[model samples]
Target chain A: MGNLRERLKAFYADYSFYILPVMKFALALGIYVLINNRLGYMEALNRLFILVILAAISAILPFNATVMIGIALIVAHCFGLGVETGLFALVLYVVLVLLYFRFVPRDALVMLMTPVAGILHMEAVVPLCLGLVRGPESALSAACGLVSWQFVEIVHDEIAPLKEADAGMLNVLQSIPASLFSPKLLLCVIASAAATVLVALIVRHMTTYTRLRAVIAGAVLYLVIMLAGGVAVGVELNAPAIVAGTAASAAVALFLNMFVYSVDYRQSRFIQFEDDDYYYYVKAIPKMRAGGAKPVRYYDDSSRQNGTGTPVNGQDVDGVDFKTKLEDSLKDL
Target chain B: MLTKQRLQLMISLADFKQSHINTTMRVTKYYRNDYVAVQLVKNFFVTSIAYLILLGFFAVYHLDFLLTNMNNLKMGRLAAVLLIIYLVMLAVYSVITYVIARIRYARAREKAEDYDQKLDLLANIYREEKQSSGNPFGEDQ
Candidate 1:
């Protein structure tokens, strides 16, 4: 595992420029494909060529441009459905943009992550990952993402009725307030914010297996809030899906934590010490390394005179002077 | 004729420039006060436009009731309420933009200072080489 980590690190360091653009392209393509599948109202916009071009452009542009392009695609699809639908989507997106840029401009991707997870029935991963990696402020972005996803779901649900209704502008506009401010959305936003904050808090305070503990706590807290809140609000609860999603989210968070904060807990130690002004207790955990300790051979003048070289266990160092190499290696250290 | 140290410094400088060019260009394009003020005005206009659109939606949603009570409605009070909402939105957005712009400018200034220091170091290296070589342009005569 340590060797794999070292290799991965080296690979990233060597070709990060190419790797980053490839990753951006992949993310952009995935987002565009999902958007087309979920809300492919306009046949022209849904063409493979158009989506690919959009993704390609987003790959080369800044990350925030990708988000903006996604929003534009969603709004375009809404416009294809109906003028009222487009207007509603425009208003909601504008408000979300204002809120996001005004408060958390740095975490633009987080605002998109929640809805994508929701589309995949894995929204729980968002808060868990956010808690593991980001500070408490990220909760706001998660909440915004949840709201956007919930609004999209609402639009999807209301699409048929909207089409059947005669001149649905007034009726649609009237219903917007109630649907957008539903109790379910409120509960979800609260639950997501609470879980993120709690996980971040636990991770901040705890020292041992901090990411692991935080992921578990965040997953549990999110599940509890969602289940309890869903019931109280009379919203039909998908208990199995929620449970499975939370478990999957926890697993994903742990996997990411393994890559980011891999440490040798077996070699961890605690020490107590005192300075002139204060006492301190410190816990130290060794990082995982690709190389184990190399055996250093020491030879005295008497051994050299006897012509008996230092023995290496199960290893060959034939025809090489140990003293010069040892001195050079020590100097490097 | 580049030495190893000089090549390393040049590489570091190039890397820094590549990473910071966008931010450096933006920061240098405008005076600090003008940038922040411009942002504030831009945010104010955006807020005003959004608030107007929201009001239009609200009016459309309540068009039936508003029409029914058209005779009884007080236009002055309604206009005042709308104006108040618009003002509040503008004020909030203005403050947010002000802080964001100031922070962006300060961060850019810090990077610019670091870049300037690197330039100075490179220049000093050239100056030292020229003195040691006893030539005006640090080249063999």
Candidate 2:
């Protein structure tokens, strides 16, 4: 595992500049393709050539720009359905944008990912991983994403009926607000929000197998809330689908945690100290390093005496001090 | 003409700017009051626009009912409720923006101070080398 980590790190370090653009391209392509698959109302915009060109351009742009493009595509597709549908989508997207930018400008990706996850039947992963990696505040983005996706579903369901009924624009518009605010969507948003906050709290407070516990607890909470709420709202609950999706989401969360934020619990250290202001009890866990137990940096005693070495609670073993530069850097915070 | 050490320092500084200093630079470019106020105003506009959109939808949805009961409806109470909702939303959004802007400004200022100290240290090194009449690519370097 350590050797594989080292090779991956080296490869990333050497090729990140080239790799990042390619990854962005892939993500853009995936998002565009997913959008087209879900709502291919506009035949012109549904072409692979246009999608490729747009995704390629988005790859070179900032991520938020890509999200904006996604929104535009959604609105365009909604417009292709009807003017009432287009207006409804436009207002919804505008409101979402306002709320998202004001509260969580950094989480546009989450907003984009939610609908995609829904389409993939992996929506549970969005909130679970969000809670594991980010703070409770990310729930806002999750909620927005959930609402956006629910709106998509509402549109999908409504499109066929509206077209068949040959409804007037006013009648179509009147039915929109009702469909958009369905009890099922509300319950799902509540479930997602609750799960996100609960997982973040568990991960933040727990010290042992934090990611594992958080993922499990989050998935369970999400399932319980969704199932109970679905029952109360008279919505047909897909028991097997929900369970399978939750399990898959939990596995994905654990996998992401392993690669991105893993630490060695066995090598954890506890340190207690008091200053004039407060007494601090700190539990420091060592990261899973590519070199295993090797000291991150070495400092001779002379360097300390000369005030050249950073002052830290470094543990010395075998004539080498494991540097705690991270502690030193975070001291001010 | 850049010395090897100076060139290395420049590369490090550029890397820092690219990787870490962008948010700091962007935030610290404005005074604290100016930054926070600007964000608050932006939030106000966004909230207003969103509120108006919601109101439009509500009005449209209830257009028939409202028209039928227009004579029976409490116009003043309805207006007051709408105003209160708008104010509450504006207040919530403004407060969030204010807090976020202040926190960002404080962090940016801290980072800017650290960057300035680093620049000062580099300047001092250049001064010391100049005082000693050292070559640009000295043996010590």
Candidate 3:
């Protein structure tokens, strides 16, 4: 035991930085995957894809609706639904998000969304999905996991039980089932399509709004095709039909975006825009190297300076950073 | 807290030593023991928080699952295996964070050293040029 400990200690002394972090990241991802696979089948793959698109684009869609969704998830579980409350909540969520985007400046929205994406929601994402799909126990556990991606397990289990239960209760579950009269489904489809446009508009305002509204306007116009498809499918404004259609809209959105976000699965590396701000911390290291190694010297009337762009020995050659010294000295002539 | 502050003081002392060429003393000795204790404590915070979230999940699941499943071979065995795996992972993560922090601190010290070295060299050149130029407005001119 003592000999093994000594050997392990020696290995750690050498390659702890690279080896250790990779191991931790692997462990975290492994644990999430293990739990997710076992729980199985979230049922609404189309809707799930739609949700991801909504999430990706809605990252900027200025809707005050975040609070409503936060409230809706809680209320949907609690109230279960009565009359048209499902539709009411769906509309409310949209209005809330729209209000948030309208009232807040774009920069502030980005700032707020950064934390929403980066810190508060980091691992909590999967856990929140678990809460959506699992029992109260699993939901609590998921909340604890925080920023987890373990929803498939919990969702599969929840949907299995709902399958045996009848249709009226499903309507009470809202456009959740995709049948008809699912105000929630109608709302989600409408809002998601609008969000794609709204996001394009907000992004257009970035650095210079190049009036590309024509392209995005064409995309939003495709909702007419979806609406026509819904009518042709003979889906009536009934509870079961609405719930089913809601799920269908999600599926369609997913299918379309599969080509839209369209990442080539072949690429081994993808940059997560989330928490990319910290990327500069590491990036600065290379730039410092690129600027060269030595104290850059030049013929000056008075004193010499270093090349790093910083003053040294409490002295500066004509009040310039050492790195900038050579350039400035050249320009001086 | 005192230990951490002292370790920080030593690191900053190292920082001062590496950055300021006027001080020509050996500082690598003063830092040796103090850093070890600080590194261990820092590792504890990391491992403990990681272990905290995992153990909290188990505690939520049930404390009695351990005693009750002491005999059941399938799920119980899985639970035990996962627990052991998680703890081992925790220790690995703790050590990883420790090393990254160490590398960053060392690299910063290296940058300060490189900077101070350049400044010292430049200062020497200035002193030499001034000596040769004979004070520009003085008797030698």
Tell me the DockQ of each model, to 2 decimals: 0.12, 0.30, 0.01
Residue A173's lDDT within candidate 1 is: 67
The C-alpha lDDT values of all candidates are 0.76, 0.78, 0.36
**How would you encode candidate 2's per-residue C-alpha lDDT over A220-299 as one tens digit per residue?**
99999988888888988788998898888888888877765553223233455433335545444434442444443425
Note the chain A TM-score of all models in turn: 0.78, 0.79, 0.23
Weakest lDDT window of 10 consecutive positions for candidate 1 chain A: A287-296
The order by descending lDDT is: 2, 1, 3
Put down candidate 2 lDDT per residue, B29-63, tens digits, no spaces: 89999999888888888889899989988999889
lDDT of candidate 1 at residue B140, scale 0 to 100: 49
Positional deviation of residue A300's Cα in model 2 after best superposition, in angstroms? 21
Order the candidate numbers by DockQ, best to worst. Answer: 2, 1, 3
True contacts kept of each: 0.15, 0.50, 0.00
TM-score (all chains, Cα) for each model: 0.80, 0.81, 0.26
Q: Give the per-residue lDDT of model 3 (tens digit) for B1-141.
A: 123443333333444544453322232222534454465565566455545544553443354565676666487668798778766865775565556546645655565566566556644544565666667633333
Best by lDDT: 2
